[model samples]
Target: MEPDAARDIAVTDRAFFHILQLAGFTGGTENLMKLGEMNWPDIRDLDKERLVAVYPIASFEQHGLHLPLLTDTIQLDAMVESMDGKIGDRIVCLPTQWLGYSFHHMRFGGSLTARSQTHIRMLVETVDGLIGAGFDKVLVINGHGGNSADLRVALQELKETHAETRVYGASWWGVAAPALDAIREAGPNGSGHAGETETSMMLTLRPDLVQTDRLHPDGGWPPSVYAGRVEHFRRIDEHSSRGNFGDPTVATADKGQRMLDATVNSLVEIVDDILGERL
Candidate 1:
């Protein structure tokens, strides 16, 4: 390659990495972008045995007054960071998807969104591409609640022809719910949106971005207990006015650390399951 062209490529790579860091990919950069910080040739030399690709899907949306719009992306990236510590060398962490379906948050400034179909299409195609690239296992680690249903749909519809190739989707929060109950200070309704739970995690992961002065209660319009059993959809404006639905006043960095550890522990078990399938 020519010197100028090579320099241009190098500059582009650095710029992209910087963008990822600003967008909440710094903590997870190492694991989420190939392995060992090696270039293409290093990857080419790796063994071709069973491969697992883990990708993060997050939303760049409103998170009340206290949290940044990229809270979901930041949290998801942190999950990749946690997972990398536990299983980095064994799996390939694909880059994270920074945009998600956050139409409800569009009313709030700083929220970015995509059509549900677009989100689904992007997820399915990404997994399909990974499988086509010879990865035997594909795991999508989701960060945005709004993307949950669509991610489930995409995971269900993946074109799987080989028993060896497995595709799975999981929201880190959901996966850690059982463990959260043991440590969470917020009640069910209090942790709904930009509530205490999420705030706590953000406090631990990116304290510099959190604004304590803006903290407030986000008790969203409570739904009937019966409605919880079924699929019911509502927008943010109709439910909560401040773009949050839970109490963030009680969030603490210590709680955030514990919750993060719980999430990582849950992922460890899940990764084992994804890679331990018998042929």
Candidate 2:
């Protein structure tokens, strides 16, 4: 008989755990889980005391023609990778929430969105399930702008319902402001959708996904067209055919790497502060 297929292993292993301990994972390996690869037993045995779980929330929205629909997810995942070893024991990075409320991009092809109310309900349920699983502190790391308000509402409700567990929601852009300022080109303001900063990060994280040849055509969208109004699907498409907001021509992989590093570093600080504070 053919041998059974070997189970997929987690990117993090015993060596990774040891390194994490040296870096500052005073907590034992019980809290860490290769969730995607591990079974229920592995998760049940996790160390609750040292676990700070993170959920990366992103959207499958149109990021112009040059970037993939998974740009937000890609960026968030890269940020998580940047935190590897640094916060391994202190923080257990959960799988990315690949879909989000993106009604604004509904008119654009390939955009998937959940209504605000639906999204909030989903978030609450998801958090509740996590709490049920024994995580005391959960961080919702959001990557899309449209999901911000709903996420806040969901977090508030989750905290009220589960007083024992604390839930924090933060937008990646908001958290990485200082770093963005440092690496930004065309000023900090130009880092809007499919703009310099995001494009830069994508270039670094998934160079193969980026089509630099289409940068100029894709970067042609004007931000002024949708400055004051709610960016609904119809209005967005009216402004640009490609569904992008700012110039992506200036993006570079090197700049993206730096921005990603800065973003993760900021996340580490935030996690540290949260852990240090008395709840």
Candidate 3:
């Protein structure tokens, strides 16, 4: 409430850092291994070949009427943040790439996307840069379902170009499928896009962004003649008029916490696999 109090806090912070410096502790050990927060030397001094470089990518697009446009990014960021807390010193995390391949959701406002090839190229170049930086192990984590195919293409291209580099990618849900299946209350039709799974995660991570009053079930299209035997592409509007898919009414913060835990635990295991050269 007063200038003296503010000065005291600042002085205490300065003294703490001063003590750290006197004890031969550089600032790096105290913080997470986030690439964006570190200086050039800090990155250059790392054991590049041994440390995993995590590049998280998500979409900035519509998440139905109830969820925020940044829902996918927010969910993915939460997973990454949790993972960082577990194994941050062993990996360097790049800032999450917010834009993704969301052309299917273009009909809805606030959705942004890049052409498939462009998105692939962007991903390729980013990983290539990490490889150039001497990081032998790289992991790309995808958040939005729309970006899944493009990510595979990008990873394939990267492998073809840099056969020796250890570059891998996985969607958060795909990696923890069994766990999600065990925890989800919704059926197959209710866990697709902007569905119970995502809603539950949002409720756990950012309840304020979720419009509880507007939550409803949508996009449970009846199975067509080629439902499971073949795959087809359709815009979100084609299946869901409200710009969402699946049921959100079944979502709860407790389910969300379980999902979050499972996802993060799987991610940590994946990082371990990378470190062990198992994948």
Candidate 4:
């Protein structure tokens, strides 16, 4: 073989190998981004200063008559997986924690929840474990609305306990709000629980789990002067008999796909910011 030809081939091979590594295929066999899939030694050897630890938290809860009980978790799993595909080796992603604070939806029978305190402890412990293992930066991605308050509490507890560590939490919708707002046709009532956004995302991620025939609009807050100004605890069954809020009948697979893609893009941006210390 000619020397120039061999040199060119070597350069091409090296570039391909770098691309593979960045895409999480380290040994041409495994995904290094997924912490659960990697062995301890691999994790221990990782560059802790640069790699961001990710925890995806969601819930097994009711999503009205149309969506499945695992709606939140499933959508979150897909979002994390997509984010992994984009930001591969930069993040050490944990498996999605499918149990969240869903006590409000317990009336529907399929919802499961950990008490708020217990859930907060669980989050703190999980993130603490990552910090113990040398990861100083952590990001918590939440999927279920009911888990939002608990996540905030958990974040506060984690920061107070691990003063030097950097921790962040955000719902997928919250992170991708700009993109969602661009496409949202529903008024305020169109996108709450089991609503257009969640249903569309579920349709895009797991169409089989969404019951199309059962699609319907369901939700309304109590009529009070303090309705929008107040934050109160209310059971799903209290106002919504169908265990949902928002309009599901208008959800479409195309909208779901767009929302998922936009969310993934937003997640990648945030992960990049975290790694760059810009957030």
Candidate 5:
């Protein structure tokens, strides 16, 4: 019957329709808006009022020999896609930002990073542009660790400047800690830059980009000594030749899928909370 009625029935008495409802088939197709697939008018219509817009922030950085430079972007995009049908109404995905503050990766080839200040300015401008276009609640889904501080600073400034807008930033990997832990249990330490988790994720998202033959020469500082340092840029090439930070030999597609699912679920919950408070 009606969507609300169907949902009610599903909640009170679970049935096959509950599965359909959970899958979002009950919600009209118009509700599913893919930002990349829509024009300005489409976006305006889809976002008639202020909406929660999710921006996938990633960097084109070195991820060792096995994974491509675009690994971060790929994983972030996949995470966004995984949440598509679930958060269709409450949220909308923006085109992925393929460049971020990756100064630490500058020591290696194929790494394109913007100056921290420039990256912050770009993010501020992007949020401003989104607000100008009608999105008031912006959720930044960052994939790189280096961009976190800049993003926080930029978002704080935005909040101070525009009281009506709210911006939230979270790293996909960081938010999916539970899943990452599960993956780690399947192997060992999963915190490397291009280590098991990241490699597994890339393998799941873009298997074609993975050069399994070149998976050797695990890049970066030894995990035991990698303290979270503000001046991480100085230890770049000194720590690793290829720019990777962790082990990737244990990466598996199954673990990647689990991590992706966990990340998307966590993001959806966070977005829902933000939207609920705002709405």
Candidate 6:
């Protein structure tokens, strides 16, 4: 409540950083100044109408035995980093929302899920908040498949409720399919969740996180046919005993780089178009 307390906090921060430097801690101070990061005070001065808010939504879920449980969230970090590098001047990149609806993967250990209704409400409020701040476009770049159905609903509801602001949602793989398809080491049947494609990407982005000893082939749990034309949901343990679908032994760092580059390029094109809209 007083100037002395504020000064004390600032002094403590400086002392802590000085101690870290002396101990050879490697975190870059420049990262503390990153413009779009929510922790930075500079965000308060940002003019929403002049830039777009790109939110990356991911999940904390199991990614087989080899990949980390946070694959979706980590991959999104890489994706957002790529985009932020090229267009920092025109975007208000929000921190990622890592919790997602992953009820299907719940049986597998380490996976966390939000109730479907709560997930929908979270997305709606996030976009609505951005619109209220005067941003012309609110874009959600989703990396988890489980969130797809609800995300579609959330985006649609946002449009109906706030017609004045343009809202868009996209699945990264869908947007960059042509490029990823050309370089992938597996076919559709061999590539899905924690498949070769994702493994390769992680190998390039964070190889240490990959447990090479666990490389194996798995296509996941299969759905059941209902009424001779429909299908019923199945649990991961039932479909994929190993908690993974698709072949992963074929992953390579090269494919990861190519995949990441293609997605970044695709996103750049999409974001440019969104920013150019006549809102």
Query: What TM-score should be assigned to candidate 4?
Result: 0.87
How much lDDT does each candidate structure score?
0.74, 0.71, 0.80, 0.77, 0.69, 0.74
Off by over 4 Å in 3: 1-31
What is the per-residue lDDT of model 1 for residues 1-279, given as tens digits with 9 covering 90 to 100?
Answer: 222332232223224333333222323474344632555455456553545677788888989888998898888778777788788766777666777889988988888887777666666655655555556577788888899988988877784534456787889888999898778777777788888889999999999999999998854555576767776688887877788898999999999999899998998788877667731
Q: Higher-lDDT candidate among 1 and 2?
A: 1
**Candidate numbers, best TM-score first, in rank order:** 3, 4, 1, 6, 2, 5
The Cα error of candidate 4 at residue 157, in Å, is 1.3
Residue-wise C-alpha lDDT for candidate 3, range 65-152, written one tens digit per residue:
8999988888877888888789877778776787788999999998988778667766776776677667889999999889999999
Tell me, by lDDT, which candidate is best. Answer: 3
What TM-score does prediction 3 earn?
0.87
What is every candidate's alpha-carbon RMSD to the true fold? 6.9, 9.6, 11.4, 12.8, 12.8, 8.9
Clashing pairs in 6: 218-246, 219-246, 220-239, 220-245, 221-239, 221-240
Tens-digit lDDT track of model 5 for 1-279 = 333432243222113223322322111123345554566567557643436887777888888777888788777766776677677777776667777878877767888877776676667666665666677788888988888899889888888878887788888777778766865743444456888788888888888998887765354434555455534445456776766666777778887788788888888888888867842
Stretches of candidate 4 off by over 4 Å are 1-32
Residue 126, candidate 4: how far off, in angstroms? Answer: 0.3
**Residue 45 in model 3: lDDT:** 85
Q: Model 2, which residues run further than 4 Å from truth?
A: 1-32, 217-235
**Model 2, range 1-279, lDDT digits (tens) per residue?**
011111121213332322222211111223334454455567678886777777677888988888899888878776776665688877776667776888878887889887676677667666665676677788889988888888989888887888877788889789889778878876644666888888898888788998888875233334676755654433456666777767788888899888888888888888887788653
The estimated TM-scores of all candidates read 0.84, 0.80, 0.87, 0.87, 0.79, 0.82
